[model samples]
Target: MEWKLLATVFASVFIAEMADKTQLVTMLFAADRDVSRWTVFLGAAAALVLTSAIGVAAGAVLSEVINPRIMSLLAGSGFIVIGAWVLWQAIHGGA
Candidate 1:
């Protein structure tokens, strides 16, 4: 277990999830449902974990086919595009 890799995963996931829709949906679901909060929380967390695992596995396979540097560049550019879109929406008040 590389601590650095683990730390990177933790930090990236935390930052990505902080403003994610899944988190918001989870909060809304928990608020609206009559179910136990702990159950909802666990369910949401498990779903997120499974989704992340899928993403990681896909990335790993992609890395084997593509240059890692190229992958990093593409991923970074994608994040930039997403951030810009969010900023645009915030400024324009979603049209």
Candidate 2:
């Protein structure tokens, strides 16, 4: 395996996940639950793994059907939209 490629993927995924909605969902579920912390953590980790698998499969399929540049553009645009929505909610105070 190429170490450089692995490192780049690790860094990109880490950055993308750090501020993503999955973290928010994990926090919300953990806080609202009466279960043990370890139980919640394990459950959340399992769910994250499953979701990541689905994302990887989707990305693989997309790569086969679309150009890499277009796929990157779409992904970047989606992130931008989510970021803008989050910012708007912060500014307006959601109901």
TM-score of each candidate structure, all chains considered together = 0.80, 0.64
Query: Per-residue lDDT tens digits of candidate 1, residues 8-94?
Result: 999988998996898898888889767789988999989988999999899899999999999999989999999999999999999
| CA RMSD of all predictions | 2.2, 3.5
- Which residue window of length 10 is worst by lDDT in model 2? 28-37
Model 1: how far is 36 from its true place, Å?
1.1
TM-score of 2: 0.64
lDDT of 2 at 22: 85
lDDT, model 1: 0.91
Task: Report the C-alpha displacement of residue 1, candidate 2, in angstroms.
Answer: 2.0
CA error at residue 88 for candidate 2, angstroms: 6.7
